[model samples]
Target: MRTTMKLDGADLLDLARGAAFLGTGGGGDPYVGRLMVQQCLDDGLTVEVIDPLDVPDDALVIPTAMMGAPTVLVEKIPSGEEAIASLRALEAHFGRRAFATMPIEIGGINSTIPLVVGARLGLPIVDADGMGRAFPELQMETFGVYGISGSPLCVTNEYGDSALIHGRDNKMMEWLARGAAIRMGGCAYIAEYGMSGADMKRTSIRNTLTLAMRIGRCLREAKDRHENPFDALLRLLPDTPYSYGRIIFKGKIVDMRRETRAGFSVGRARIEGLEGWDGLMEIEIQNENLIARLDGQVRAIVPDLICIMDSETAEPITTEQLRFGQRVTVLSVAVPAIMRSPEALDVFGPKGFGLTEPFTPIESIV
Candidate 1:
């Protein structure tokens, strides 16, 4: 089915909140993304979302995304043309006529990026994404798990520079993409991993886009009803357990350290906890929080959701968007069962982040 909607500022804010929730504490900041999409809406652009099933079985679907450091993506706003350039480059490289475009990940800015690309390219946005929750590496996609190749991937810098990256494997594609992104000043526009709807059915996480919308809807309703939004979200995903933790840290951000290294938002935060707990807590982030330490001793890490939410309102905060002096809550929710598999560990475990010991799921730790 094809549907068109007029997404205004309120819609964008709600969608951003919902996208953050579905992001599972990983998709980059939704703030900039909401602003960009709102700009498109202001330009009288109507974003159309199409069900993947609406496309022909053999329909060629290309996923478009922003690659590099999320921190840079905010300062260096996309020129819009680069998103199209990446899409066009992929079309030319494949030597096949293009089909539809889809969001690669469901995060803040990326949630609506494909809509910008689709509006510009005159393509429809696929009502789904590859990963229901964001991961650090491009190869961590369920699309890759189902045997899809990352390249020949198309990338474009805001300066009109464009290139095609080919590699022996997905890992190589991820490495080269990150390197290129760093060279492009910590962020690059990417249109990659073209595949069919049938393949998507096999490889992609189903209904993630719809889920994002629902997640967004839930938050909006929760807020309007003056109910506990976070609790409502926990109830929505019955399959995922809540790993509870105190508001160990709540204070002004004293310091923030971030770098776009190895194609990830690697950073650390120093926050002083208030109320009962006092002192500083250190958070280590790479796309997502992998470790939380209190005065140099480990507190919470992977396998549990080491979530940072707006302390006042309980909205989720992505690693890249974190700033100093922002009051936030650090909650450790249990990891979903799907992420506990040995394969999942290899992709996002403690060892994956170069921690010395193997991962002990956050559920076990908490």
Candidate 2:
């Protein structure tokens, strides 16, 4: 089915919450994205979401995102032109106008940056993305997994400087882009994985924007009705690509360490279990929560989503936002089918992140 949806102010607010949740402790903060979208809405611009099926097979589609440490994004806010600049640079290199823009990942700011660019350029945004959840590097995208080359990648910083990287594969592109971001100030806007609409329809994670909105709306409504937000989330899980999820732990952060290094927010958090529970739960993170261990036993690992939320409000806490003594609840959701395949696993599995344990599906673990 082909459908076109419009996001208004209220919808964007819900989307911000859901996108942040889906970020799984990465993708940068959705708060900044929400502000950007709100400003666009206030300026009378419209954001249109198009189903991938609606795009012409021959049409050019570009995925745009912010690359580098999420913490850096908080201080060095984008000038809004960076994303557009990257897209324009890519167009110049490819010699074709982009038919539309889409998110590289439907998590946090990356999810909304494309919408901002699409509105500015008066183009539709395909309701799909490269990664259903956020990943640390460019090569971790499903597009890369499916053999899409990330050549002619474009990167731009807030100061209006832009660079185009070519003659390299996706993995090399990540390294080059990361170094550029570090040199430019630790964060930059990137546009890569350009492809034909047909290729995107085949490789992209479909309808994730709608999924994030649905999740945000569910949590909001649950709070308004004084219902348990956790139960609301669980009830809605079956309808999304991630059909299984559970609160793996509830505790207060007792120890945490984080630093922005090599364009990534790398850190670990230790939580003291509460409510009659004993021992501690530790989470390893690199931009996103990669793994969780309960008293040294693997409970959840990357390729699956390990999410942390405020214990009271159910709002997601990004890796950079984790603070000592803050009560939190950890949740794990099964990743989309496309991301769980053996091919996809090689790019984001436990071993890929230097963990010794073999990747186990969250469903199998819990």
Candidate of highest lDDT: 2
After superposing candidate 2 on the true structure, give the runs of residues whose Cα lies further than 4 Å from its correct spot.
Answer: none
State the RMSD for candidate 1: 3.3
TM-score of 1: 0.85
TM-score of 2: 0.98
Weakest 10 consecutive residues, lDDT, candidate 1? Answer: 239-248
Clashes of each: 4, 0
Q: What is candidate 2's lDDT per residue for 1-366, written digit by digit as tens?
A: 666999998899889989888889899889899888788888899999999899999999999999999999999887568999999998988899999999999889999999999988898999989889999899889998998898778999988888888746778888998899899999999999889999999999999999999999999999999999989999999988899999899999999999988889999999999976678999999999999999899899988889999999999888888999999999999988999889988987887788899999888884
Off by over 4 Å in 1: 1-9, 24-26, 239-255, 275-281, 293-300, 333-340
Each model's lDDT comes to: 0.73, 0.90
TM-score of each: 0.85, 0.98
